[model samples]
Target chain A: AQSVTQLDSQVPVFEEAPVELRCNYSSSVSVYLFWYVQYPNQGLQLLLKYLSGSTLVKGINGFEAEFNKSQTSFHLRKPSVHISDTAEYFCAVSVLHNQGGKLIFGQGTELSVKP
Target chain B: GAGVSQSPRYKVAKRGQDVALRCDPISGHVSLFWYQQALGQGPEFLTYFQNEAQLDKSGLPSDRFFAERPEGSVSTLKIQRTQQEDSAVYLCASSLAQGRTEAFFGQGTRLTVV
Candidate 1:
């Protein structure tokens, strides 16, 4: 019923450069959006979440994403990234159900920052 | 515990063998979740538990997969007759409440079926 699409399978950027990871979702009803980051051999950590708030959401590590309803997009952006920012990013959606909300995730985008 | 913890950081099983993955959620967490992450793919929800009750299990890929949170604090996902397709990282997560709460994740157990 609900699905997420991440346009970029991988993104390579130089250190101190700006980067954006694109995400789009298709849902029939209202949804909650989130971005998660996973470093090598570690669990996923929440970067940001868009519940019922402003379109622009700021997250950890100077990352931000704007929820565009019309475009069905929630693209993650960073003004300047460092070498440590290399990780896999995922876009996920959750809709309230009778039991509870379950997360449906997109195919992740691997962000590679080079010196 | 400070965060969700999963046991058997790595497991190697021969094809057709059975395997069991364990999860220890944060104490007092009301919600626990199980997910499967394949190579180069995001984690996929496998099941959900509220306390000791299994509220949702629709995401399980097959009947061979079984899960239980008998006491609510600890949960286990058992796979019978493991196959190569079942090789993946099994993640365990916990949340303080049922809805709209942040879910904390574990490092995950990497299962490899040969």
Candidate 2:
């Protein structure tokens, strides 16, 4: 079984400030990593995913994350944030073609971009 | 539909009442998934379907929870004898294929059991 861990439960940043949300995963085999954002009362929207290729994956809303294999991490980063960026972000993992495409999600990190 | 759609955006049920939530996946989607999200927590997988066949259901918390995707397009999750613990948002997602693909999500059905 695969699992995801988000190191931070909440992240607060001022408008136009840079922010990073840490995520780590534990799995015996290869996996697919993803970042999803959820606004209040809304469903999750895919921010980005790491299937394969470049370690640095760019996502919507100027967010990006680098996949670190040795560290087992896929941390999401945004160089500059806006007040509208405030939302809950989730880090998820799916086993590589072996686990039937089910996603295991982290506890989530709530990002608050203050004005 | 252009995207996944779930019915009854919000539902309030008395304890012990049975409730059913519906999900309509995007057209031509091959894989559909169900998840449950509690307050302040990430969404947890509940079940999965490949077309009309239910292949994975290990994530369903209890026997009280049942999900089916008939005709390979629309799905329904039925909860029997709901309890306060069952209050949560139910999310449905559909993917283009069976593996390593992005899944589109629905707005979710929020269920409140009292």
Candidate 3:
């Protein structure tokens, strides 16, 4: 079985400040990792995904995450954040070759960017 | 049509009442998925369908929960004898293919069982 763990339940940062949302996963086999953002009353949107290739993945809204296999982590980072960046972020993993491609998600981290 | 869409943005059902939630995936999407999101929790997988065939339903919580995608384009999740614990946001997602593709999600239907 695969599982995701988000270290922080909530993160508060001032506008233009850098932020990092930490995520760790436990899986017996290789997996695909993803970060998703959800704004109030809206559906979740993919922020970034790490399938293959480079370990560092960049996404929309100036967000980026680095997949560290040794650490079993995929932490999302933003050099600078805006008030509009406040949303709920989720870390997810999918086992490779799984027929359904079902995603296992973490508890989620609430990112609050205040001006 | 342009994106995944779920009907009844909000639903209130009395305890013991049955409810049905609808999802319309993007046109021509080959894979559809259903998920349940509880308050302050991440969404959990409920079921998966591929072109009118239900390929996986292991995530369904109980037999009271039923889902179907008959034509593959549209799907429905039915809950029998709703309970307070059943209150949650039901989300529908679709992808162009089954594996390694990005899944697009709908706004979701908020179901409240009183």
> Which is the leading candidate under DockQ?
2
Indicate the docking level reached by candidate 2.
Answer: medium
Q: Could you give candidate 1's per-residue lDDT for residues B16-80 as a string of tens digits? A: 99999999998999999899999999899999998998999999999999999998789999999
| C-alpha lDDT of all candidate models, in order | 0.94, 0.94, 0.94
lDDT of 3 by residue, B12-105 (tens): 9999999999999999999899999999999999999989999889989999999998887899999999999999999999999865899999
Ranking by TM-score: 3, 2, 1
In Å, what is the interface RMSD of model 1? 1.2
Q: Cα lDDT of model 3 overall?
A: 0.94
Error of 1 at A26 (Å): 0.6
The per-residue C-alpha lDDT of model 1 at residue B35 equals 93
Record all residue pairs in model 3 with backbone atoms less than 3 Å apart, i.e. clashing.
none
Task: Evaluate residue B90 in candidate 3 and report its C-alpha lDDT on the 0 to 100 scale.
Answer: 96
Worst 10 residues of 2 chain A by lDDT: A94-103
> Residue A106 lDDT in model 2?
99
**Candidate 2 deviant stretches above 4 angstroms:** none
